[model samples]
Structures are given as C-alpha cells and as structure tokens.
Target: MTATAPHFEAPPVRAPRRSVQALLEARFAALLVAPAMAVIALVAFYPLGHALWLSLWKINLRFANTPWVFVGLGNYVDAITDDARWLNALRVTLTITFTSLLAEFVLGMIFALVMNQSFKGRALVRASVLIPWSLTTVVSARMWQVIYHASYGVFNRILVDIGLIDAYKPWIISPVFTIWAMIGADVWKTTPFVALLLTAGMQLIPGELYEAAAIDGATAWDRFWRITFPLLRPTMLVALLFRMIDVFRMLDLPFVLTGGGPGQATETLSLYTYRVIFTDLKFGGGSALAVLTFLMILGSAFIFIRVLGAPVAGAESER
Candidate 1:
C-alpha cells in the first residue's frame, strides 16, 4: 500500500483559461470602435499625409501650364533660413503666445480665487466671467475691432476719462499697439476659460488640506503657494498646453482684427500661411508652413507630456 501511494504523482497545476465569453466581449468592443477609428484615419490621417506629400512639391497656380516640381524640403529651408517674413511671423507669434499666456494665467488665477470665495452673487459673477469666452472667436475679434476703433471706442473713452491719454489712440493702426491690442483681447477672452478649468481643479482638492494648513498658522498667500499652487500645477500645465496649441495656430483674431496688417507687424504663422497659399497661390510653400506649424505644436505637446506628465501622474497617484 505504501509503495502504491508513493508511485502516485500530484496533478500538474494549470493556469485558468480565459472564458470564450470574455474573448467575444473584447472582440465586440473592438468592432464597436472600428468605425470611429476608420473615420479618424480618413478625415485626419489622410489629409495630414496629403499635406506632407504636397509640401515636397512646388505647385504655383499663378504660372500657366506649370507642372508640380519636386523641391525636396526646399520650401521648409526657405521658410526657416531665407524667408524674412516667416522669421518675423515666428517672432510675432512667440511674443503674442508668451505675453498673452502670462497675462491670462495671472488674471485667471485671480478670477478663480475670487470665484472660489463664497459670495451673494457668485453664480452670476461666474456666468458673467464666462461671457467673453462664450462668444465665438470671430465675433469676439469683431467686437474688439469695434472697441479698438480710433474714434468713438469705449477703450479710448475710458482712457481719456482716466486722463491716461489726451486723445483717443489708434490702437489697431499703430504697429506698437496693434500686437499689444491683440494680446489684450486674447487675454480677456481666454482668461475665463483658464479660470473655469482652474476652478474645476480646485474643487477636486480636499477642504481638509486647506483647513489643516490654516490650523498650522499658514497665511493665505502661504497656503496658496505651499498647498493650492502645488496641487493646481497639473491643471495649469494642461491649460497651458491647450492655450499654447491654440495661440500658436491663431488666425481668426489676427485675420479679422488687423488682417495681419500695419505692414505684417501682427502676421501670425497661420495668417501668413493663408496668404501664401490662397493669396500668393503657392500651395507647396503653404503646405510646408502648415506642416512646420504642426510639427511645432506636436513638439510642444510632446515636451509637455514628457516633462510634466510625471509630476501630474504622481499627483494623481498621491491623491
């Protein structure tokens, strides 16, 4: 009997197999997503590939019977190294981007803080704050254009009333004022969006943390810097990313407000690209500009994800 028991071996352990139902469910989910994937590939990827292809060839519609000439990054090289207007556009774009971003962020933080405070008309105030942002960009630009009119504009009236200027200034016509005026309008329109996003993020922060900080004898500013600011960083980064992408490709405001005018003083990359493509009939050059803009935006997003993603993820995990 002992010899017989010793001769028996334990059954080998086997991993549990996935059920056919689970496999079927996964396949069904993939099938459900296929249509959306196909649409994206068709609408987005196809156009993007076409643009890249077109960027390599010179296609000037202005010339009769001219065939597509392969330039092999000539447009890109011209834009980057040889094109003075392109360089100036780049400078103007960067100036507006950074300046407007800073103003919006600071004002947005202030607005968020004020809105976060309990008040009798907080809801109304928040709704009012969102009004500027709610307007379509084109409409907002048109409105601001009216506001920046040299004569009979409220902006000049306010300045004159405050004794800041002797007369109404030509804000849109002057090169010095044109870009700044655009920056101001951009900040006014977008700060609310930034504030709204920050407010949402602030809501996620636990009240206990603030209370504990207050108990530790931390001042309001101290608490904000030490607790609120740190916690809000992830949200700020996300807002910055969105705003950067938008402002980089900015067209409507500049196009409508100044028409990239006052002699190309306020010309953005997008507006310049538009001019090149449609106005100058240079499809290849315009495509190259579009591709370059896309690359810049993509690079910026990649940097944000790679650099700031870790901290954001860590914050989420901690929470």
Candidate 2:
C-alpha cells in the first residue's frame, strides 16, 4: 500500500512539425543557391569535362587530315615518363611555388604585424603596401624586367654599388638566377596580398583576449604565440592555399618577364602547356597537361582544406 505504482502515460506522436520546417528551410536554401550552382557548372565544370575528354585523344591540329585518334592515357604516360621538357618545367614550377610561398608568408606576416600596430601613418602605410599587389601581373612582370635588365637594371646597379657582386650580371638569363629572379619578383608582389588577409584576420580577433592576456602577465611574443597565431591559423591557411594554386599555375609572369626563355630555363608548367597547345598545335597533349595541372591543384587544395578542418566549426569546437 505504501509502494503504490505511479501511472505513466505513453508519449503522443506529433505531426513532426519541426522536422518538416527544417526540411522546408533546407529546400528553400538549396533553391536559392541553384542558380549559382548552375552557372558554376556551365562555366567551370563544362570546360574541365571537355579538357578531360580531349586529353584522352591524340589530336594534332597541325595535321588536319589525320582524324582525332583516341589514345587514352597515352598523353599522360608520355608526360609522366617520356617527356624531359615536361619534367624540367614541373621542377621549375615546384621550385618557384615553394620558394615564393615561403618568402611571401614570412614577409607578409611581418608586414601585417607592423600594420596592425597603433602608429602614425598606419592607414597610409597600409594603402601603400598594397600598391605592388594591386598592379596587374603583366604590369608587375614588365616592371621587374626593367629592374633586372642586364646593362642598366636598377638591381644590377644597386648590387654593384653595394659590392654584392663584382659586376652587373645577367639576372633574367643564366638558369641559376632566372628562376630566382622570378621568385623574388613574385614574392615582392604577392606578399602584400597575404599581409592584407592576415591583417583582416587579426582585426576579427576580440580585443578582450589581448586585454586578458596582458592582465595575466603575458608578453607580446607570448600573446602572439599563444593567442594571435592560433586565431590567425585559418587566415594563413587560406592565404597559403590561394598562393600555392596561383604559383603552381603561373604563366603571365614568366611569359612576360623572360618569355620562359633563355632555352626554357624558367618554363613553368603553364608556359610549357601553352607552348604545346598554341605553339606546336598539339591539342591532345596540351589538354593532358591541363588536366594534370588541374589534378595537382585539386589535390593540394584538398590537403589544405583537410588541414584547415572541415565544417570549419570543428576548429572552434576544439577550443
């Protein structure tokens, strides 16, 4: 009698209104994005699909009489195995990519940090720093060419004055200096873009974090390492991802500066592909190279996206 059983009622099944609402909202969002997706497919996917399809064939536009021969994977095999020029171009591409990226990131970070401080002329400094990045690749490349000119280039003159070298040497020629010259120019122009991204990222960080760190007896270096750097990780990853792709597929700079010349010493993958397609009129081989370049870019992007942490919220959740 003291332990009387309490009666419990079974839960009633509802109309699932919340789930229905969520489903409807999702559908609405998808509908809103449909147009953009369609445009991207039309512009991006169509060309990529066409290039992939074209790569499987042997189509030499030079010989109009010969039919488009289907040599599936043959072009890829040649590029991977038999092509010496392709290998050299790939090497040059990677060398510039890594070297320029490192220089840009380090210098960009320094610039960003300097620009972030509360100092006189900060606004003017920031704007001026972006001038290099704002210039078109062609303009920047031509400008650098003038600076690197053999006889009267400013760079050679400066080096001679500084006694860095005995005499003004060829900056855009001589395989040893050609690639490096391009890298130097690229880093100078691109570092500003990286700095801009980082500065924007820094602005998003809450001032309270810095204030709290200061109260807790953290030095500037300690705060940067423990707070600012961690917070800026996403921005840095984004900057690097953009730069890696741009550097890997670079064409205009090398083409404009050195014409990928002096015996193809600085020929990038894009330059070589351009020569193959437009110069030699080998559409199939050119398309194969394009496809390979796209794949490499995709793979690198995938790795960066992975390291950046998918869902993006995952990084926030970890903290």
Candidate 3:
C-alpha cells in the first residue's frame, strides 16, 4: 500500500535553445567580442587600407606642387625588378635575422643551462645576465659603436694586445666586417633575453625525470639531449620566433650605428623603408615596400610553425 502511494517529482527542464535567456546570453557574448573586433579593424585594418591606397599613387613630398598620380602596382614592380638597393636590403635583413638568431639560440641555451643549476650565487648570475637585455637598443648600439671604434675601441685594443691583430682595424668601415660587428652587438645584447626565457622553461621540467634518467645511468649529455632539449623545445621555438620577428623589424641599431652605411651593407627592410619614406620622400614606394616586408614576416612565421611543430596552445584550444 505504501509503495503504491509513493510518487516522485521529475528533474527540472533546461531552458529552450532559442529561449529569451539563451538569446540574451548570445547577444551579450557578441557584444563582448564586438569591441575587440572594432579595435583590431581600427588599429590594423585601417593602416593596411591606408597603406594600400597610398601605394597606388606617386606622392613624393619633395614634389610639393605636383598632384598625386595613380601608378597602380608600379611601385611593387619597381621594388622587385628595378630597385637594386631594396633588393640588397632584403638580402642583408635575411642574413642578419638568420645568423644573429642562430648565435643567440646556442649561446642562450648555454647560459640557460648554467643558470638552471643549483648554486649559491645563481640569483646574482641571473641578474648580471639580464643587464644587457635591460638596456635599450639605442643605448646598446651607441655603446657598441664606441667599442668598435678603429683606434681607441676596447675590442681592437684587446685584439692587438692578444696578438689576434697587428693593428687596430676599422671594423665598421669594411662592408664585409660591418655586418659581423652588428651581429656581435645584437647577439651580446639579446642572448641574455633568450637565456632568461629558456631558464624559465627549464625550471618547469620535473626534477624527477632527471633523477630517474640518472638512475638509468644516463650521462649529462644524454640527459640534455633526451630530456632537457625535448622538454624545452616549445620554449626554444617561442624564443626563436620572438627574436626572428624582432630582428626582421630591426631599425634602432642600424639607424644609430651603421645608418645603413659602409656601402649599404647593413640596411634592413625596416631601415630601407624608413629611408624611402623620410629620406627619399617617396610615400608610394615606401608603402609598397612596407607591405612586402609584412608579407615576408608572415611567411617566416608560417615556416617556423611548420618546421618546429609548435602549434599555438590558444589556437589549439579554440579549435
């Protein structure tokens, strides 16, 4: 009789998919995303559109009285076929980006390893390592300019004292050596930053893995190659990507130190773009060059993502 009399209530139902509450939540989400989309359009797409419009004209400020004439893609054509200096700048930019980043990665990894060790003075060492990175690019370039001076520079003096050279050479004057000097300065200044990133990555790795590897009789080199490098690959790729982008857009050092001098040996795409826009006063050509440079950078990022297998975590989660 009790069982027959007993009754139970069903679970409460969820609101309908197209209900007022669901529609309100959907609208709120769209509203939140709208601001970001608007900001991106304003900051990024607007400039790109303006550049595209500018690129279609022949507007040289030097010709103050002349009107803006449409040249269509003539600026782009000249950049590829006619402008030798622009081509040279592209070559130099690629050279610096590749070589400097290579040295930075290797040296940075070494510094990271040293800093990751258990030591009494580790904090001090880490601080000292970051000093060069903390200094502004302009300050570092100007300082290196003095250091690379032919006669009175510390570098030349040390080389002479050590018998590496018979005389103080004009390091910045030679086209061949000028890039090397720039690379040296860049590597010295930014390697510490790479090291800092790598050190942080290394710290995240569990010590248990290393201890287990040691128990299995793995040598230091084996542990590094098998465990450390494999684990730190994502961090290394991220550091490499950042430095690549930075070096691609490098201007402050070249502007201050080389001025794209010694026969245009150190002219980067960014430096070249600046000179074209301000020095040559050809806004159309400069805008075209800017667009081309942007495409190259995008291509490089694509290559890195493919070669390193470092799919962005946020992108993966979104998918």
- The most accurate candidate by lDDT is 1
What is each predicted model's overall lDDT from 0 to 1? 0.91, 0.90, 0.90
- Candidate 2 Cα deviation (angstroms), residue 158: 1.7
Model 1 per-residue lDDT tens digits across residues 48-115: 99999999999999989889999999999999999999999999999999999999999999999988
- Whole-model lDDT for model 2 versus the true structure? 0.90
- For residue 103, give model 1's deviation from the true position in Å: 0.6
State the lDDT of candidate 2 residue by residue for 93-117, as single tens digits: 9989999999998999999999888
Per-model clash counts, in order, read 0, 0, 0
Q: Write the candidate numbers in order of decreasing TM-score.
A: 1, 3, 2
The TM-scores, one per candidate, come to 0.91, 0.87, 0.89
**True-structure Cα RMSD, model 3:** 6.7
After superposing candidate 1, which stretches have Cα over 4 Å from the reference?
1-19, 310-319
